[model samples]
Target: MGRRVHWAGIGPNPLRRRVDRAEAWFAMVLTVAVVACGPVLVWRSGETAYDRAAAAADWQRNRFVPVHAVLLQDTGDFIPVYGEDGKAKAAVQAEWTAPDGTRRVGPVIPPAPGTAGTTVLIWTDSAGNPGERPDSDPMGAAIGVGLLIALLLVAVHAGVLLGVRWWLDRRRMAAWQQEWKDVEPRWSGRR
Candidate 1:
């Protein structure tokens, strides 16, 4: 038959010290606190992230306008430029009609590599200035925030647990030192 494993300070035992009992109880309370608070933290973080993302998306949709621009020169024949997505692109002089019905020519980075006269879609502000693409995925942002919060919670819990264990070990060592001081004198017949 296998012997039952005994956890220190978990149950009544004559050998258990006060520090051990305190450590066990503290560990239990910390576990309960994590279990109770983890979901709430993740939910709140996710909600805040989603709200900000959605608001930004709405603002971008209303503020930016899409227009077709024609490339004035060939790309991919010179040094390649990379976009935020790490995709290869190039900045070339292109011409487009602005919202005010006036012709505008400027350096624009097309979404893909193309030759001269290739028409490509580009985003422009109300003043016809080129802008980066807006984020449209609020759900993705929420999920990412939720996951980050959850990871932080786990890290905090582990840190707290380690701190409490270190404190308890210090206390136990102090108590053991005091006990040894008392016993050593009698055992050596010096008291």
Candidate 2:
């Protein structure tokens, strides 16, 4: 539990003293619950859609940079594609717009893998013309457990509020104390 902070002059505020100490214990429990379960909630071992996007993003950031490629349409601008290999290796049939307003189309040889949402692939024919790569997809694995943890944390916060409200009700607590008091009456039971 964190040390209670008091106001500069008045030790602890009067309202703070009225606040039940049990409320603090529940807050501690909620914090520890999140901290203990957080790692498991965030991570998933099996693969899913989220994992694929993460994997692709990592590969792009680490392995290569996007290339300035032209769209092969008779009248279309250019978009960027990740390069095949090192800087020296030019993209075959890789479309790019030259300084002039013309589409520079070349066969992107060897054929590259498709990306997350869309299948963007090209292969160079014998004449060095780029064509689409064969597409194949089944159920793929990914990582997306963080959402579950977020829901659990929300529930914990609700529980904390409920506990605090119960503690603040004086009558229920007073009645409970009275029952206990009658069971083990004080020495001066005249009252």
Candidate 3:
């Protein structure tokens, strides 16, 4: 029987459902994996890059730089700190768990573009090692999880759709075969 797998409405013509989604367990597993893994992959790579950039700079000249382009003032957080010299600079801070339980906090000078808010990024002078210089890839993580969820959904959807299409196509082809069979009988022994 000629049938095509349905995925995003794209299929091979004169198609055959070579693959069967009878178990559906595999589809579920893929969905779970995509939803679980996408964010980890995206965030980790981003964080690695951030670490590389952080390593390149001198910690003594600690400053706040956006990981992603965003406005600080708009977020309404005062930032940028200074040392005893009164020269605006970054400072090293104690690292520990924050009351927020969900996130950790550290001492920050809160530079001109400083804030605990995710909107503003905190930079550290290699020496300063501001607590804000977290290795956590929050943005990457968020995006990765989002993508993962989307992928999982897409995979499941594709499986469902393909199954339905396969069933329909099989039915239709069976009918056509039957019709052809009937026609053959009627035309038999005719000239």
Off by over 4 Å in 1: 1-8
For model 1, how does the per-residue alpha-carbon lDDT over 14-132 read when each residue is reduced to its tens digit?
68876777787887888889899889989999999999999989999888889999999887666878767788777888899877778889988888889999999888888888877
Candidate 3 local lDDT, residue 42: 54
Q: Please, what's the RMSD in Å of model 3?
A: 15.0
What count of clashes does model 3 give? 15
Best by lDDT: 1
Candidate 2 per-residue lDDT, tens place, 27-91, comes to: 56666777787655555532344666666655544433223453233211224344443422223
Judged by TM-score relative to the true structure, which candidate is superior, 1 or 2?
1
Residue 17 lDDT, candidate 1, scale 0-100: 74
Give me the candidate number with maximum TM-score.
Answer: 1
Model 1 score (lDDT): 0.85
lDDT per residue, candidate 3, 106-185, as tens digits? 44444443333334445443333333443444455555555665566677668875776587678778877999887887
CA RMSD of all predictions? 2.9, 13.5, 15.0
Q: What's the distance in Å from true for residue 180, model 1? A: 0.4
